[model samples]
Target: MSFLFNSYPLARAALFSMDAEKAHDLTLSALQKAYDCSLTRGLLAAHPQLPCTLMGLSLRNPVGLAAGLDKNGAHIDALGNLGFGFVEVGTVTPKAQPGNPRPRMFRLPRAQCLINRMGFNNHGLDAFIANVRKSQWRSQGGILGLNIGKNAATPIDNAVDDYLLGLEGVYAHADYITVNISSPNTANLRNLQGRDALSALLSPLQEKRKMLEDQYGRRVPLAIKIAPDLTTEEIDVIANLLPQHGIDGVIATNTTLARDAVQGLPYANEAGGLSGPPVHALSLAVISRLREQLGAGYPIIGVGGIATGRQAQEKIAAGANAVQLYTGLIYQGPALVQQCVNALR
Candidate 1:
């Protein structure tokens, strides 16, 4: 564990020197190899105080690795070993697609942020399910959140079909599933957050979920991941709809399209969602508003710009039942997971 903490600076330096997307690929490859060799097990010291429960799932800690980091479930065990209580993978679609073109991911080192328009480039549900089945963490009953989305080619009006397909495919394998309709990279995807669209999307999915529960003999929870760029009125509408739809939880924020916080920085004008410190305040604001509308019992998984222990604590204070990380891992290294867990304790 100490070795992991001590060695990351040099590792990060090498990664930071390369193209952001390439660096990400290399990191995933290395992590995969480490897991294959069983070298990642116990690589971090576990914090006992981090235990909690959300959406009926028993999390070993409140800190989790966010979706988009694993897009596929390929590295769940390896990531789980890094001290996150849970690991979410995928914004996986029903079919395999290449996603947006190259150089789609950027790093704004000055703001400790990243901008990406990767779309939902995943190896389709078949490959994703295979990876999920291969994961040792899943075998061990570690909480796994499978995030689902529509294919880029799927029209917005017919988007429900794609989501329904996603639901049917991953339902049995996931501990909970997240309907991701807020990524800015996907065209018109955020429109699903509107009142009519949101209701239309969730109502049928909720019906299917009940049928799935009867088939599987367990009621796997469903959470919706929303964007941070929403207006207060938009938040109010969503808050009202969630419980009405019988949704089990909400992940407050995907990434933001707004770049106000990173103005003047390189890649600040990139056409994608901006994450890291720039998103911290926006995410907290959304969570605070959602907390106010949803009352005390609804589960909210807050995620966005959580780069430090204090920020993680602040998210909880703002009413998140648990929190997740992605860009923070890029700048702060894996130790951030334990740092957050310790702070939450």
Candidate 2:
């Protein structure tokens, strides 16, 4: 069998022919069917194990699937079979939402880029936890990170409540929980990154985490996802505050609002977050700056525009403890996982 069950070039050609979001849904559905029929992990290429630890969590490899790929955790077993060391899912909100209008996701094959304004459209928390319960991925021992975000209708000031609710629901199930305050699709969501705002948010969250740790008997690490569009002073402020508030780690970036790298390209002017090759340098810049401020031993998961093993190595070279892929996987295929682990090891 080939690395990805079928040659990815063929699969990509087929998928790329359809509307971006529809193709996304079709792919996941087919994978779920493949998994249900017991094709399971064997249907996908097996990545070599490159053991490492991150924020006290042991991973078989450091290459992981970034969030927004499987928003509801419905395809965990199928995706987990593809050989990611960890699979992070969702940006799921408290209520089911339809997200932004049609054509929300766009591809820029020219630069291997994607622009999306997907506004956290996901099944509600209850349904999400149910999907988590149904997943067989955890039995295989790879780590799982559950990414959570606030609903669009929720007032900005009240966002902490939504995050708190997310923590309460996913805390017991997650190997680590990612607090998403960085997605540009949601209104004023990025405002949560401000000094006073971050302080306010983390204080309650860390306090709640302490309570949950005592209750669940496991202390799931908490990571805040930030945007690549931050200022130097803003980055420094967050770096200092993380340790102070007991935030365990930081996912160096979500996506970029700047289209500097994709100017004049179709969808380059789309009103959404830009991800892929264009965001690679921006993500690396944030990761490097974060490392300089956070110093060694602080966990950072570098992601954005990593389409090759060399770029994956570059993230580590820039001080990332591990790396993740979203747009890269869309364009480069599952083979990128093993390639990255092989390179990292």
Candidate 3:
């Protein structure tokens, strides 16, 4: 692995220097091509006996690949082999979109961070489910979670309809569904975090979940993905409101807007959400606070700036049932996954 990455550092540098969104497209295409071959898949598979369970779904390990990396489920088979306990695909919308304009993603390698306002650009629900359906790789005992959201044009007042549209399409394929109400890119979308709005958003979704249970002959858990930029008051509100809506779990942190850690770097002031080392402290703080309010047994998926076994252990100690990595993978490569899993064990 060292030899492989070392030789390509210059190539990787050139890719990073290009347009961020376009580079992502090229990277995904390359991965898909590599994974289409049997040899690469075999190389990426995890060892046996690495299983962990959360929210009724058994995972191959506790470490997972967070959302935004595979926006449309196009590379599930390829990525599944990299040994993630779980892989979350999409922040899929009720309708397809082109997302925000060019240069919407930026890399802060010095800080091991990424800032993106890709605006949930993805193929619509049908295409998303179709891609997921085509993937041949399922975790040996691992789980798959689908993160759902509203279309960029969907009015905040009617966000429930958009979420319900996604739930209808993805419920059958996912081990669990995440309600993404925290992304800072959409106009006023975070307003759904308010009391009445959150209730309006979740109440109908829970009803749809019940219907899905009846149709599928089983229950599927539902979780909410939050931002790391909230205040103590906002966190308290979520802890109080979650149980009321039968929320199955919480994904504590998507990305952050703060620049404290990435200050003085190029692209540091980019208009998007940042995720990486800069976010480590804030994300951990949110997890700790949530644990304090929600108490024991509230399932939390800790994500943000986790790159080492010690970092993963810290999140677990802070009350995360499972942990996820995005930026860390960008900085450390696939081997980081196994390293952290081994360390946790």
Candidate 4:
């Protein structure tokens, strides 16, 4: 643990010097190699007190690696070894897409935030499923969540088709499926959160889920990832709709378009969702509101700007059943996972 903790500054310095996306890719590749060599598995610490259950899935801990970090499900085993109790991969679409062009990811070191317009760029559902099938983590009892989204080329009216396709493809392999209707990057994706469109989208997916449960002989939970920018009324409306649609859980946020927190900082004007410390308060507010509206027993997975043990505890205090990390991992390293789990315990 000391070696892992002590060495990150040098590693992060090297990564910070490179392009953000390239550094991300290189880091994933290196982590994969480390896991393949069985080096990281022993280095990671596990807390017995961290176990918890949510959405009927038995997680070894409440700390999870959020979606967008491993968008294609390509590094599940490597990431799983980082001591996260669960790992979510993808904002994957039914078809392959290149996402936004290069320089699409920017780092705001001063704010401990990131702004990305990656646009759900992934290698389509088939490849994504294949990668999941190839991962050793599935057999190791790691809880895996697959987040599904519509293709960028698919018109908003036809969005259900892409999600249905993605659901069909990853259903058997995932512990849960996240229907992502909240990404600000995919043009007009957030519009699906409106009352009429949300109902139209979730209704058929709920119906299809029943059929899939029977076919697969298992009931994999379905969760919805929502945006943090929604109004109180909008949050209340969606909160009411979740139980009505039989959705299993709600991931409190994706990212934010608001810039007040990062004002006057570099990349503050970049046109993408802002994450990290800038989103902590807003995400917490959404979680608290959702918990109030959904009532006790509804699962809420809190995310956004959790960089310390106290922040992780705050998410739980705000009524999250579980919590996840992404931007925090960038600034704090893998030790942060252990810290949060210990804090929760």
lDDT tens string, model 1, 15-76? Answer: 99999999999998887677677445456434435668999889888899899999988888
* Tens-digit lDDT string for candidate 4 (182-234): 99999999999999999999999999999999999999999999999999999
When summed lDDT is taken over every stretch of 10 residues in candidate 1, the lowest stretch is 39-48
Whole-model alpha-carbon lDDT for candidate 2? 0.91
Candidate 3: the clashing residue pairs are none
Candidate with the larger lDDT of 1 and 2: 1
* Clashes found in each candidate (C-alpha, N, C closer than 3 A): 0, 0, 0, 0
In candidate 2, position 228 carries an lDDT of: 95
Deviating ranges (above 4 Å) for candidate 1 = 44-49
TM-score of each: 0.98, 0.98, 0.95, 0.98
Residue 285 displacement (Å), model 2: 0.8
lDDT of 2 by residue, 1-345 (tens): 355544778889999999999999998998777667755546664766989999999998999999999999999878888889999999889889989988899999998989899999999899999999888788779789999999999999999999999999999889999999999999999999999999999999999999999999989999999999999999999999999999999997898999888889987899999999878898899999999999999999999989999999999999999999999888878888888998898
Error of 4 at 97 (Å): 0.7
Q: After superposition, how far is residue 261 of candidate 3 from its true place, in Å?
A: 1.6
Q: What's the distance in Å from true for residue 56, model 3? A: 1.3
Model 2: which ten-residue window has the lowest total lDDT? 38-47
lDDT of every predicted structure (CA atoms): 0.92, 0.91, 0.85, 0.92
Model 3: residues with Cα > 4 Å off, grouped in runs: 1-11
* Alpha carbon deviation, residue 325, candidate 4 (Å): 0.2
